[model samples]
Target: MADLEDPPVFLGFDFSSQQVKVAAIDGRLDVLHQSIVHFDSELPEFRTQGGVHLHGDGLRVTSPVLMWVKALDLLLDKMKTSEFDFSRVRALSGSGQQHGSVYWRRRASETLSQLDPDQSLHQLLQDSFSVSDSPVWMDSSSSQQCQDLEAAAGGAQRLADITGSRAYERFTGNQIAKLRQTRPEDFQDTERISLVSSFAASLFLGDYAAIDYSDGSGMNLLDISSRTWSEICLDAVAPHLGRLLGAPLPSTSVLGPVSSYFVRRYGFSAGCSVVAFTGDNPASLAGMRLQPGDVSVSLGTSDTVFLWPQQLRPALEGHIFCNPVEREEYMALLCFKNGSLTRERIRNQCAGGSWEVFSAALRDTPLGNNGNIGLYFDTMEITPAAVGLHRFDSDDTEVSSFSARVEVRALVEGQFMSRRVHAERLGYSMRTRVLATGGASSNKEILQVLSDVFNAPVFTIDVSSSACLGSAYRAAHGLVSESGVSFFDVVKNAPEPQLVATPHPAAQEVYPPMLRRYTRLEERVLQQRPT
Candidate 1:
């Protein structure tokens, strides 16, 4: 037990797409401190736009491993300048952008096992990685590798049944296969591979950290049911692939105490425990403290919808991962590439770059947007695998365009309706409640459309950084998990999710027919695209 005078604090970190963020929470579960390090602005030497380098081919994307390391150094120094009491930290955990992967050189583990307190991590581990530029979730260059893996596992649906998701180009398994086949010399020189989540854990543990099952399930390499690496999937990727990726542990497992380097340099307590990290989406689910029948929709730069499903429904469209906090359960996710930026584009074009104007347009248009629907993807979308702007009228006929006000309502409605359609395909029902988080969740006008589309009440939480806060909650829960206290019990005292929007009574009448028409229009859009 910690001293009563100074309550123990739990730390949560999020290595997101654009930045690395940290949040500290006291024993009462209230946020005590928060900080961030932006990659593009803070570390311009890496030359990253949106914290990633887009290849000339437009499908390949990567981030500098050293830039991530350097960002940590900057973040901790910022905390130190803020006079944060690192000595009071009891346990720490984090979340990483899903599907990003890191490769270690032959002697990198040896270097990690013996880090020096005097030298910064960036200096000591400058040459430790076999591949300096790690492939991230935005990457989509491994289509051939995806097809090959699916065929090896006896087709798409069969593989989905085993791994909780069908082979996706961004999944780590396909990324690894692409690297091994395309860069054989680099592959031969590599000793181990770590998901971005475990790679960050390794930095704190002073050695390699076991990949948690929740993050491993995103790789298309782990068997979701058995919680172990699949032999067939292993054989399909590379020889002796199981050994490269160490045995995965539960998300709550404590790897060990923080490395002595932190104790000597940053004043972290020697007894501070380092908990296994997980993917950002899973961490958000934990942070929201979702109930059994709740679905979470995160409206960020790239919108994502996830749910704690009663049963696993394997599909090619979305993803299912091992639940971060519950061993016997699973969570499903759907990603939309065009979320905030797409909304911003429409707002600029239709409303002169004012969100208030955008909201007014939504209010002016009637429900269903008078049967106008639009699908806008500024970039390639993952869910339906389509790109570009598409519009349709009430008769299900493709249209050149719509009025600006109609376009605004159509865009918001189309986004939520697609979420409902894809979610239903994965066994989610309309009756489940919604917990909306992320930057766009504060927009009641947008959430009203979401509520109407799903015909469910929309709830909002107060936390701004769900992924980071979720990691802190997990850090606290990990301390009590061995004694059998449920995660819900641990976070029960946290603020209640506030009711933000409820469906209009007439929503039940207007949406059913509109949804049917939208589905047909979506099929037409897919047919027009080049596969």
Candidate 2:
């Protein structure tokens, strides 16, 4: 038990796209401390760009499993230096970049159950990974595998009916099947497979952690309706997968105490409970403490827009995932690959790398950019299944260039406008609020565009990392939630979500036709298959 002298705190970790971050929130749900381990710059040893290694001509992305382990060690050490009282931390939960996997070798259980406090985690477990490189969500190399799985499950629509998503190349069903086919030897050697979230939780529990329900929904293995593994879909992907995956638990289930590794090395109490971790997007939904109709727009390395829907309505364009906290509830999400990186590109090319200049330039252009709409996909995009940068004038004719200011405006406007179009396609409507989060949400000018395009009030929380904070809140909730308090009631008093930007009433009239323009242009782009 922790010292009753000081109030308890909860720790939340986000194993995100670019970094591993940890934040602590006090009993009242106020953020007390935060720390980060950036892969590219801080941990030069990993040599990762955006926390992953890209390969296979841009179709495959992976991160070293041990690199994440070492990052965990380094982040805790940094937190220790900040004088965060681990002994007072009653519970901890985490969120991981969605869909990336971690492979454990046959000796992994033995390796994980016993760790040397004298040796860093990376040093002791160097060879514990059966696959040195785990396939991540950005990998598109699984098209053939997706096809095979679709065939097994009957077809794409049938699979969607069962699994809550279509046969997307990035979904874990295809990723695992590809592993089974391409690296048969490695697959045979693997003892367990974990989504990156549970993998992080496993390190703390001194055992393999069960996948959380919300994170498992992303794997295309879970029947979101029934809340169990889809036997038909599982058999279609790999052999004996359920054994490797173990049983997925609720996001808020407390597994056990903190590992002795932390109890001995740091001053953490052995009573510190480790709760099941979940997908980053789900955590964001929790962090924002979404109400009935609010849309969550996360602007991270990938821009994801989600809404907590009343019931399951799986569609082909986006995905419907199980809600993290509640049973019999679901979430609808649409991801756009070109997010912050694309913003950085236009900031460099148009405004010489100055966000202030970029904001000024963007503000200079009118809404709808004088009837000019553009698409700039730095890489292949998720929605609309398109790639390449395209610009068009008022007449809808493709143009070579616009003024730098117009380009900046188009990039910001086009991204949010597309989000609106596809969101409606999924049968979602803009309700009272659009809750914007992630790194780019700090930009008022950019958020203004989001507000205008969505034609709803835009809001941002004071906390920068929504996923991590959500996990922290979950940690607090998991520990005392048996008292029968609702999740919203738990977070209601922490801080009011601020109304940051409001849509101009004129924007309602201006954006509808331009959204139509963005749709036509996207159609043209998607029609031309990769040559």
Candidate 3:
């Protein structure tokens, strides 16, 4: 390990929906310490499952904002136990779960500014939240609100052309509207609204933080082309929405020095700078240091395929968000709700709950699984908005079920095929090298299939959390940082991602027929759904 006198390290935090994660890196771009604190497992008193409180048949998903605050305390404590040096940190940046909103109670900023160094953060600010439970990215409780907002903007396509998305229930615009419609009292009491990213930054800066343009884009309130809140969407969502949100900023912009709380309580230097935090996906993009032709496939709870787009071409199908670090660039994103969890369903039901068994099942099945394709969505899916697990034979006839081995192959093939379709629909070419991240990135069976479906090489980074590493890297590339270089300049010399699996030669012949069949089946399933 390098001596404590080594060049000052930069700090990065990832305040995700489920946990608080941290990573520190030295000036030479080497990792110093990295760790995480899960909200449910570590803080059992909160009684959260996957960091969410679900209701109305899991359509409504919320997480206690205070839990995120406490997670910071626990995460910092863990870092201290590992002999982490807060004094070595010269700059800090972070990532948060995109689109989740935190409603601050009146005088919340004053409460934050006066946080007692003697008391824990969560304990001091228990009453600072106007809405204790925050509506998160998983929530779908605001369908009517979404429709109303869409209609108010003239139509779905018009809204999509303006804000980079048609109205989405999980988006902050609709969630804010839902809160105002259902809980007018709480809405009235709320002094300021913060996206989850800005809320985490507020805790560190001891002040209200400006929302980052990248995270703001996810809210369906940002005019993505201009990187500002759309007045049309704002008027539809609420009164005084613009005043509450304030202005958006570049992700790499430093807000100010670290709060006195950390300086006194954690031995951090008061001079350490705090940079604005952004969404986890954009952080991943920065961490990965994506090239123009590179595609990112994140296999998390929600599977996503993204690419750095040259132009802001918004479509009704997916979304376009401002690039987190490169303020002028935009990113195209296509998310599929049925990702790892759906894979788990097939793994449990068919592979006897063993990934080993699942791998064995994949090995047993042929490349095309004998012309069998499966559409597995354990819940309502976002990509095509299709529900149910439907199976089809090569002839396009619906089948009740397939063999266990076939089921495993079909699940892997189907998920990637959907990603391929949606990415193409959004004007993304699928032939580039795919940088895969998140939990499932390690699965060779999955990567091999991903490579086959996209007809590209798949690679995984060496670091554990791309978001955290990305955030840490951002800390070094920010305005307050010592590096004084572009993010690309800093990361270009970093370790390259490990090549996982490549598409088999036979896959070229196999996937084309299967993709065509999957396309037809997707159309059928979408048509069969009640409109």
Query: What lDDT score belongs to each candidate, Candidate 1 first?
Result: 0.91, 0.86, 0.86
Model 3 over residues 79-144: C-alpha lDDT tens digits? 878888788788899989988999999998899898899999988999999899999999999999
After superposition, which runs of candidate 2 have C-alpha atoms over 4 Å from their true positions?
A: 40-50, 54-58, 114-119, 298-302, 339-379, 388-413, 438-446, 506-531
Candidate 2 vs. true structure, TM-score: 0.86
Task: Give one digit per residue, the lDDT tens place, for model 1 in 17-94.
Answer: 999999999988989999999999999999999999999998999999999999999999999899998999999999
Residue 157 in model 1: shift from native, Å? 2.3
Query: Highest TM-score, which number?
Result: 1
Across 234-345, the per-residue lDDT of candidate 2 in tens digits comes to: 8988878999999888777888998898888788888899999999989988887887667878887989888876545677779888888765577788989899999998
Off by over 4 Å in 3: 1-5, 55-59, 81-83, 114-116, 300-302, 340-373, 389-410, 438-440, 443-445, 480-484, 505-514
TM-score of each: 0.92, 0.86, 0.88
Q: State how far residue 277 of model 2 sits from its true place (Å).
A: 0.7
Off by over 4 Å in 1: 1-5, 344-358, 369-380, 387-406
Error of 3 at 20 (Å): 1.7
List clashing residue pairs in candidate 2.
Answer: none
